[model samples]
Target: MKNAELVVIPSPGVGHLISTVEISKLLLNRDHRLSITVLIMKLPIDSGVDGYINSLSATATPRLRFVDLHLPQGDSASQPQDPSSKSKSPLSFFANFMDRHKAPVRNVVAELTRSDSSSRLAGFIIDMFCTAMIDVANEFGVPTYAFFTSGAAFLGLKLHLQSLSDDHHQDITELKNTETELRIPSFTNPVPVRVLPSVVADKAGGSTMVITHARRLRETKGIMVNTFMELESYAVEYFLNSDKTPPIFPVGPILNLSDGGDDIRTKQSRPIMEWLDHQPPSSVVFLCFGSMGCFEEDQVKEIAQALENSGHRFLWSLRRPPSKEKNKMQLPSDYENPSEVLPEGFLERTTEVGKVIGWAPQVAVLSHPATGGFVSHCGWNSTLESVWCGVPMATWPLYAEQQMNAFEMVTELEIAVEIKMDYFKGFHGDEDKKPEILSADLIEGGIRRLMMGGESEIRKKVKEMREKSRVAMAEGGSSYNTIGRLIEEVMNSIA
Candidate 1:
């Protein structure tokens, strides 16, 4: 048997890195003849994946290795740039950071090829944002594959919109704030412009960056998405039939379902689990926005009021917003006193009924039998986690492609209730326009609908999808077969 090696390049964000690592594990476990080396990139802001990586490294096997592309000494690329500059968006900043590492990546690839004679360099698997690394793969005379961390539906929408822009010269940025509805093929219903990704909808540099990545995707040998065919059958079918896209592999529902290592186990895990232990099965609503999700004090107060008024057993993961300083590169931190932003005496008022904690162990919380429903920002990973655990969701999208994911969940899948589908909390450097705050009544109504009964339509649908997700990853399943096909393609790529 021929031994082959593949290199994976993931984005700096923890969410993207987690999914990317999961896929790498799947590939390694599926085929014994293959080895994977993941090239890690550092973010200008510390997103705290180092501890997770260190833990993995401590237990890593011979076939799996992690190489950190350390930032150059005294390099400004490691520091936060001017956040006040309106011209820079998050995507652009990330893209520029990745681009600066081209020389280092090339050096690593050169070393790998020179050091290994028994194991042939098969191909490169790059995150969607790291498409610029494709050029390096080309230089080494190897094929490049894109590992899309989001769903197939979002992938289709991105490619379709980019095609429209490139082939027909349509300016999608002009559709921002309009009532125009787009007939995207991936979705069953017409998608409203308001729910478009903030990067694509706005006329910022990020829109151009998104298009560049989409165009680069078309250059890959194949695209492996972190979604199964059952969850996104229409989009998968569309890609399989279309001649425009490269071979599409729906090889996931890939997730990191562990207890999130020691950091999670030691901090707040026991209390949260203890509280869930006493609640009735399917009684508590778990509200955890993504790592980057946070709101202003006024919106936080509204959420507190809604949770109090609903009277449902609840676990809320509330985070403090990042500082508004011009040059600080920071993520949302856990509030020492959540009551500072929440309603007066709210924690005291709901002592028996609810628990408010900072930085939840999301996978652990979702898998708890007491967790009846999820009120999420509709990030794809969170959506998949909820589906995998058979929990229904109340969608409240904040930014990025979350609005698109929410639309698919509510309108297409019918597995989630909607709080506000088109709510856009603009990212850093976005125009100074505050999104409309959802009222307490509106939020409470959505929570009621989400957790009303054990036999609700959405609940049933989520349970059904959860089973499908499992089957998709099982042997002889859709994702399983797709992974086999991907391995075959990788082996065949070697000249």
Candidate 2:
């Protein structure tokens, strides 16, 4: 048996973990003798996400193990309160966790180095957020590859925007003051500041995450992002040709590897999928804002009223009100009751057209023939999933780099169209009121455009892109070849 081992580090989030598992599987599927160890803290029982990790452990044929690096139990009270939720400030708690835990992770690296298999530690694959892993890899003289769970367009913009930050005198919002265009090398469209990831454009110096990211970009030995070449060929080409850029490998549609098929079949994802099945094809518009995003109760009501008014079939994932207390937050008294919150006689009238639920099987819904369009927050995973499903997007980017992703989808690649935007400036924190929300009228127009009328042009382009995505994963496609080469390279490095 070949004695080679690879350690994969993933940030502690559902999206990051899921993508890492897919790459782990790709490695094992190709090399039977490759021993793999995944470094994660612990699985949360509440979310039922543990199954994904266990599933990989069960199928990795040769040898695979999880090396859990956990936080001290007594420190639970001190555990950062996911500053993301607590602070609306531009700072990211995700980066803070990394900064605080670097020492413990380094200790884990030392423990691995002392093992009998230390000599066999041939490679390290780490999420972009876990930049500290590069130092660990250097400690043992192992080559490291930075694994980006997002698409190429967002990644390209991130790198490009970082460079722009060096020279531009003003912040992202100020850049938006004049309708100035953001000129990135790979993309043809000049995106506005309002369309970039919120974090990058913020002038607040508290968040050093982007600084770390820029540094890692220049240091990593190789770069790997979870996207196929066909879906992001332009961005991929630019990265490859850049001076001093690490070797770029586009390997993904990673979620599609799930044997459960495109639908969310697990108990957690089932209820959502079941509801989607009852809706008619090409008629129901699916809207999901990912796990972390939240909107005010009134915004939710407005969206509900708009969908009802448009007379379009729809499925919405609504978050429960923040606090049920009378004073803390006020929801439409009828909000909990579907009949009261929906248009008068709306439920009965649109019974054939709409379904409202707390959550829905997103992938299955998108892949379904009935789901003609997605109104989304434009997260990288959602964007890629929509592309894989031949579904066109009605982009409504909420926060983070999502706006950047939405801009690329609409303006750069022309696979989707943005809902009309109203920007808010001088907002100190996310907890404050949003500057603008896409009203029902804008949402209705977006749905109509993407579903029919002049929007058919975008739909046709997406369908063709979907074919390209399929081919890239098939027998002789670019992504297929890249995966094969990556496995071979890892194995050869060991020998």
The candidate scoring highest on lDDT is 1
The segments of candidate 2 whose C-alpha lies over 4 angstroms from its true place after superposition are: 42-51, 54-62, 76-78, 82-93, 113-119, 165-178, 256-280, 321-348, 421-433, 453-455
Residue 92, model 2: lDDT of 48
In the range 87-154, model 1's lDDT, one tens digit per residue, is: 76555667678888888889888999899887999989999889999999999889999999899989
TM-score, cand. 2 vs. native: 0.85
lDDT of 1: 0.88
After aligning candidate 1 to the native by TM-score, how far in Å is the CA of 78 from where it should be?
2.2
- RMSD in angstroms, all models? 1.5, 4.5
Any residue pairs clashing in model 2, and if so which? 272-360, 272-361, 281-370, 282-370
The worst-scoring run of ten residues by lDDT in candidate 2 lies at 325-334
